[model samples]
Target: MIITFITAPILGRLLHPSDFGLIATSAPIIGFVTMIQNLGLTQAIIQRRTITKGQTNTLFWLSLLLSLTFATGLFVLAPSLARYFQEPRLIAVIWVGAALTVVSVIGEQPMALLTRNLRFRLLAVIDIIGIIVGAALGVAIAWYTRSYWALLVPLACTRFLNLIVAAFAARWFPGRPVWDEAARQMIGFGAGLSMFNILNFLARSADNLMIAKAHGSVALGFYDRAYRLMLLPLTQATWPLSRIMTPILSRLQGDPEEYRITYISSVSLLMLAVQPGLLCAVIYSDATVALLLGSKWAEAAPMFACLGFAGLHQTFTSTTGWLFISQGRMRDLSIVGLVSSTSTIASFAVGLPWGPLGVAVSYVISDYALRLPFIWYMTGRAGYVGVGDIYRTVGPHACGLLMSASALVLIKASLHAPSLIELGGILAVTYAINSAILIMFRSKRRLILQVLKVACRSVMLHRTSRKGRF
Candidate 1:
């Protein structure tokens, strides 16, 4: 995951943002289909108290049945659906993607075992290996062919590899499917999560479709790149947090109060550090885009600036959805989906006329303005996480970000940056200075000091460990 995160800049430098945009356009349709394949069985396994081998086999067979059904439907509809998007070549692409159905059938039980055991280190390693291989393939193919298909197929192929490896890695072998009673208990949970995933795709994909329809694929490409960049910070925080905190949250599950406290603390720490990193990226949007992507994606710089504010909004609310899931308050999650999708669809309806730029603006408003309030309510009422809890965690970071933003703008404007290298340095320095001032003035002097102490300790420990024998 870390390597993939770091490799993005290299990718941005190599491929056209439009290439990414084109592939992103496929995601909604593909994900919509994938949602159907799961039928909630996988998630049901995770959230269940116990999943027997026989029941797991039943779920696996059911998943395989769904996969073949969906694949057949996909193959038959592929050309028409491609034409619907006005990219008829997509039919062949979708045909190839349909193979995942067969490949993933063997994966459900082993994957469930891994999840049941909470062995995410193996999971992460598998993820990283797949990405490393896929990214290498993507870069090589893009550099050689410069075709959008290169990006599209590599994504599907990597998942196929992961399913194959992870299936065997967990040492679970497949057997005949048998109907089981335990499987029935999991149906509702799976259905709800599947529905949520579908709508979530629509909410996100609506923006891409609108942008593509109004602004064209070239512009949507730039918009997609910006959105991807915006998400890097979330990925950074969530990837690790999901691994570490979920177990902790699971242990504290019997006590809502403790779970709530730990949840809020985890979110707070994630937001506090990620805010400045994203702020720097936003401030240096032009430089960063230019440095990584060169002149070809100059349009993406403004797009990055446009979508960057979404990062701040996400910092507070991203994990709230998980909170709703953890406590079985999925009604809140459904509400979140309903409201966010409605807001985004409505915003896209109103904003598409203005093209990609308008889409970016509406995204920020719909996400922060409409969706956040509901998330706040959900987390507060269901998770028992208080309003003050959020205020305490996010308030200082918000202030620091605001300060950093102001300094960044001034520094960028003042320097008349001629290169990405210069702009990155200026943004980093200004953000640090601004953050320092904010930290000193904020009443959370104790928290600030604690972070400093940890930083110093980490450095000393690293040095000491290096100097001593392994």
Candidate 2:
């Protein structure tokens, strides 16, 4: 996540916001194809209590076949995707990007095997390295070629690499698959996860598509960049918790108590990290854009504010939704997503009125409205969490964020920063200071202090060692 945040801004600057937007246009296509490849098998494996070599082989072969089929189909439909996106040139990029789906399908289930066993560190490394590689490829290619294709040039490479690395790391060569009723049973569960993912993608990407359709690519570019930059800090921080906890939840699948406790604790941790991020981003919107994306991207600032709050809903809801998967209750998730999709469509409909900004506001309101209730209702089955715990984890953060936003408003009320760079620097500093104070006063203050102390000592030790007993 750290590498992603650092690399992404630099990469965004090196590339054009339109580069991001162009890719955004293809998001639905890529997302749809990726969803097809998953077909619920990966989730099924994670939820499965026991799996032998024979079962794993069956899942692998089925997944590989799906990957090949989906990739070919995507490439074939590239022109249709280009037509849908209204970008003629996107056909080639779509075709190339489709290959990633092929690679991912081939690699995904093997990765799921690792998740099934709780081998997360390896998973983290794979995720971080793949992102870093892809982002670096984006930067380098965008710098040299200066075309939209640069966005995907690294993607295909990274997917291929991730597939190879994950397979080798797992050391589980897939043999011929045996047809088993058990395998088919897993698919029923996987189908539910697949439904949630497919619709969820539509829900999440609604903003970008709405912007592009209502406005234009250029306008979409600005909004997309703002959304990405604004949500970066919170997403980076909380994403790991989900990535780690989901499989951990899967391991504790039968045990509702553990699942609920883990979910609530993780949500609390998310609040601790994310609360201040929302406040600070709203306060320093322009500064963030200028510092991270250069002055050319100042238009993305307000939209960033919209996404900053929207991110809170996404982060928490995604975590809470894991219970459905862990508890093997995919149907409930599918229904929740169906209801939430209405909110998404409604948000886009509202976008028609406000343009990009309006769309963003509608998105936040609808997202929170659905997620607030959905998270509680889904997790209610497990005793460790309930509707009130959601309020508990969320309310303080709201208070703290409100206080920080108030302070920030007072601080910057008299000053209108003329330059993007200045605004960015101000935000960078204010957010830093505010974030530190916020965390320092959170429930984890003592633990943070201890970690900071340990880090300081380690840095000192390393420096002393380097200076030869200085």
Candidate 3:
């Protein structure tokens, strides 16, 4: 995340909007294909409590075979995809992406093993190294080529590095596949998850697809960048939490009350971490765009604000998957996916002709007015989590965000900051004040302090151990 944040702006300046759009156009297709390629077996491996060497070996071979097939298919279909997106360069861009799928296959089983064993620190190190290396490569490529391929080659290289790192870190070797009843059961579970992933991807990408088709590449470029900016911080934060929580929750599955408590606490902490930042984005979209991507991207500011609002609900609701997968509720999760995908698609269609901002605004409206409420009701029905519980968990953060927004509005109305830096400072002060108010609440205060203590101790221990080793 740090690497990307530091380098993305430089890449943005080097590359054109069309360059971003061209790559963005291919993402939905690649995402949909990768879902099929993995067939959700990775999640299956992580969710399962016990597995034999033979069972894992079988899944590993299955993953490799599927990945090879998908890579070939994607490569063959590159021309058609390029034609559809109407960008000839996409043929090369997509071929590179296909190579990434192949690279990912090498790490699939290793990643699952590492996750199952809860070696997250090692996983984090592997990922950080991959991302850092990839970011550097991407910036260099953009500097030299100034082409859409610059966006793709880095991803492929990153996957390749990640595969090598994860294999070494996992310390696991694959044996020959044994196709038996155990493999069948795991594949059956994964098939259900695969379907859910497909629907989920469609739900997430429908807007991108629609924007690309209706608004054209340049328009899509603006929307895509806005969407990327909105999602990056939220995803960087929540995705890691999801990785940690899924296994932990799966381990606690037998204890229903503990599961509920864990979910509520985990999600509450997520909201506390993300909502204020999103609100800050919402209140200061123009400055964010100016500072992050330059004034050339001011056109995306409104869309970014809308997506920022949607990201809040998305951040809260994304944890639903952790709960569902942890509990082996794939069928239930699939149903939720169906409803979510359908509603989101319909919303995208309704907003299509109006352009990118319209699509973004509609998405936010649909999330609040339809999708989130329905999801809360559905996920809560199992008695482990109640809709009231979700409301209670997120309510304080929502209140804090509202207060922060209100304060920001008053500040903007009363004073002109004269520059983006001063404006940022003013917003920072507003957030600090709001944070202090929230900390006045004893429970939030305790949670914040506990988190700080844990973080500090971890850093200190890491330093002490390094010194001892040296």
> How displaced is residue 207 in candidate 1, in Å?
1.6
Better of 1 and 2 by lDDT: 2
Tell me how many residue pairs clash in candidate 1.
1
Q: What lDDT score belongs to each candidate, Candidate 1 first?
A: 0.72, 0.73, 0.83
- Each candidate: RMSD: 3.1, 3.9, 2.2
lDDT of 3 by residue, 1-470 (tens): 67777787888888999888888888988777767888888888888888888899988888889888988999999998778767888788777778778778778888889999999998888778777777888888899988777787667776787788788888878887888887888898899999988998998888877787777889999999999999987889888898899899989988989998888778777877777777777777887777778778889999999989888778888888887788888788889989988998998898887899888888889889988888888887774777777876777776777788888788778664337677767757766866776686666777789888999999999999999999
Pairs in clash, predicted candidate 3: none
The better candidate by lDDT, 2 or 3, is: 3
> lDDT winner among the candidates?
3
User: lDDT of candidate 3?
Assistant: 0.83
- Which regions in candidate 2 have their CA more than 4 angstroms from the true location? 253-258, 381-384, 418-470
Give candidate 1's error at residue 169 in angstroms. Answer: 2.5
By TM-score, the better pick of 1 and 3 is 3
lDDT of 1 at 116: 63
By the TM-score metric, which is better: model 1 or model 2? Answer: 1
